[model samples]
Target chain A: MYVAVKGGEKAIDNAHKYLAEERRGATDVAELSLSQISEQLSHAVSRVMAEGSLYDKDLAALAIKQARGDLIEAIFLIRAYRTTLPRFGYSAPLDTSEMDLDRRISATFKDLPGGQVLGPTFDYTHRLLDFALAAEGLEPQKAEAAEAPLDEEVPRVLELLNAEGLIEQSAPADYDDTAPVGDLTREPLEFPADRDLRLQNLARGDEGFILALGYSTQRGYARNHAFVGEVRLGDVTVEVIPEELGFAIEIGDITITECETVNQFQGSKTAPAQFTRGYGLAFGHSERKVISMALVDRALRCHELGEDQVAPVQDDEFVLSHSDNIQATGFVEHIKLPHYVDFQSELELVRRLRRNAEDNIREAAE
Target chain B: MALDSSPGDPSRKNWMGILARASETDLENFWQLHGQEEDYDFLRRPEIGLVMVQGRAGGTGGRFNLGEMTVTRCSVRLSDGTVGHAYIAGRNQRHAELAAAFDALLQNPERQEEIEDTVITPLQKRHQQGRDDRSKKAAATKVDFYTMVRGED
Candidate 1:
């Protein structure tokens, strides 16, 4: 005896009503303006932009507000908007060496050139709750440090190793000038992606998933013995060469985070033993994501270096297929859809099998 | 494109930077002192809109949508028919109008020298000095390193 349910539309409407109420909990306080979300909760906006694969701050902030602070949903909102916009010309690759470093640090060398500029980091002090910050307008701010923007190009520490021919020099992985750029958004991703396409895919990959893969590697899954060579956060000027204009003009600047890992690569038949490099670049101060990306990137490079692919991270098909939040979310959410029709058929089949078994038992008894 | 290049200084980028750095007070004071007499008509009225600011991944790569920023832009023409344009950050409509007017006036040969000396030159100097001083102070904290050269058998 089975009863089929109805009113899916009504159920969906009521669910939305509940969501609205939950979103605006205690409306007497105030509705958050998009500007407040953009400026105050900037890291969230940055994350949405990075993960959404879009860079618009205002749109990201709006998405955050509309999505009730769900970072992934906000990312989805931005992505939807981004798809509608026409493609402008692409800019030249960012030169991190010439970055206007706001914060640059190294874990390898104690002292390196362009001394570690520890600018506005949460690294030092501390997880302890500041009770004063909970209340509004209590303490007056101290005057900002006399505005000395050093604007010095902090050179990478690995460059020193690179100078001595200690690190493997980067060559074009697949030698082809004017190689056609691969876009995951435009075309479905294929197996054994090139470095350019792989990086692009990973750059916009799900932060949590990428972090997990990276974590697995750190827990000795791939065990590359990687160290954070250099981590930098700064703005890089974007330039586009117009077909008519014939030269590049600085379109604007974008804030970015870049991570480089000095990885241990054992000498193989073709190559000698030296340090290998993994690069991670993201839209904003996304250290964790970028760091994770670097680790996963190195892990993915196992096959190319003639290393055994024993781990899940070493499987490009598994890693790339599952990394995208949009695809994962879509498939994951689809399960919540009404599946009565599908389940009813399965239920009927099981019932028929059970009835047949009972008849067989009765026959055996006779 | 009536001589996009400034005569004394050909770099419009430098002047644009100066204009961007100019405060409301500086813009207002300049008009009060010398720009009051300029007769200009609006070629393009001041209006605020979102401009898609783009960033390239790595410095050079495939384009990613960096984000959109609000920009207030306007254009004006002087009585002598010198056209001027202003593109500025934020939604400040009045500032855009004033900037547009000054842009037209600056193009006028009669007013170019006076505007260049009085408004442009001083602002450029101040901006340059501010940048130099900041860089110098930052340089003070720089750390120099020396590596040991090892000899192997």
Candidate 2:
């Protein structure tokens, strides 16, 4: 009666055993350590952490190792692990104005305050393959003396323009800074999302998918002219307050990447022309992700800006809903699960309809 | 954004920060030697679970699911009525229990100074040292160029 269940349990158990064995790979080869993955492959760990939405470098490292360096798989592992923990409390949003700047640059200004730091970027690197890195066991060099810590604050490029009424105002005319942000994880996302919600979606959106969508906007999909106002990467303090304590405490610092792009705007009938901004921020030094996100952010703002929403990336619901890889991957991979019961019923219905049609045709012939 | 308003009253915030930043090993080792003599009942037994991580594109933008990570959390109440809770990243139940024990100890007014000196100070030092090491490595690559002043003949 339930032949589908027969032998499946044992087969599944053995399959898991085989997978564990396969995960070990060749025993002769030295196994990759979590520390190596966390340190040497830090960028990968950062990407997984960013995409997984959890900031623990240790967990991300373990995930990468467990997933055999498959980043999406590692992200999935991190995501699943994150779901069960108790919510300590929401962290106070970071004050990036005081970011411990690692990398800061402005495309709009040649010599901006907090002079450009091209820190460890691949931008100027030749793409030549380094044969030296192919071999193993290089001695860990002692670190050089650190730079004196940057002053706690730096002038943001966007703020400089805002002071002169160049960029569109960030807050509303009567902006309440205390308004509760929409948490997409806690509640369903409503259409025509506010800037905060849209940013949240993009922040966790698949970097590759968001990059392509953002790229699309640049490639004439929504040809909005944009100049990189500022790009900064740094560590920001995370602070949280317990309800019982009734006061704030610094939790820790997390590294973040922020991009602010100034887009060209024309005067509409009701409003005067001003430079509107598109913003992107992500968990780590995801320069590409942030830049792409900024472009898409501007593209998505077309309707709000009184511009025609002709581009695919400009479709708010379409972009927001499809951007998450976890949601997308879960739904897509679910297809492999057993669907024979539903398929059988549909098959029966089609056969019955065909028989009825044949009988009707015979009667008509007679 | 209002979430940043100085978290709760400041006094407890400082200690909670200490609690949040300590590595699992540091907390465990500290508890193993110092805080292990206390009697406590499980208010919540240590268990593994998931938390949905959310991220905002660029740091302050809209939120999206980052993914999940495994966490172990435990809660306990000391015999003397002090309550404690602990949540650490990953699936180590022993670490959670030790953390919970230490958390209760930190809340104890009588033991606060003792625990802070023995546990928090060492952990903070380690965290700072780690940061210093990272900063040093990154700073090695820092390049600075100076502009020359024009000279009039």
lDDT of 2 by residue, A1-366 (tens): 111434578889999988877887999988988998887887898788878877778888899988888898899998787675666556556677777677788899877666666666788889999777787677655545556534334688888888888777765466555666677777899999877778778878899999999889888898888899888887776654445345555545677888999898667799677888888877767898889889998899888788898888999999999998989998898777777777788899999999999999999999
Q: A57-123, model 1: which lDDT tens digit per residue?
A: 7777899998999998888887777665545445455566777666777889877777766655678
lDDT of each: 0.71, 0.74
* Model 1 stretches astray by more than 4 angstroms: A1-18, A140-148, A173-177, A268-272, B1-153
List, for all models, the DockQ compared with the true complex: 0.17, 0.25
Off by over 4 Å in 2: A1-18, A86-88, A141-143, A266-273, A330-366, B1-11, B25-126, B136-143, B146-153
Q: Highest DockQ: give the candidate number.
A: 2
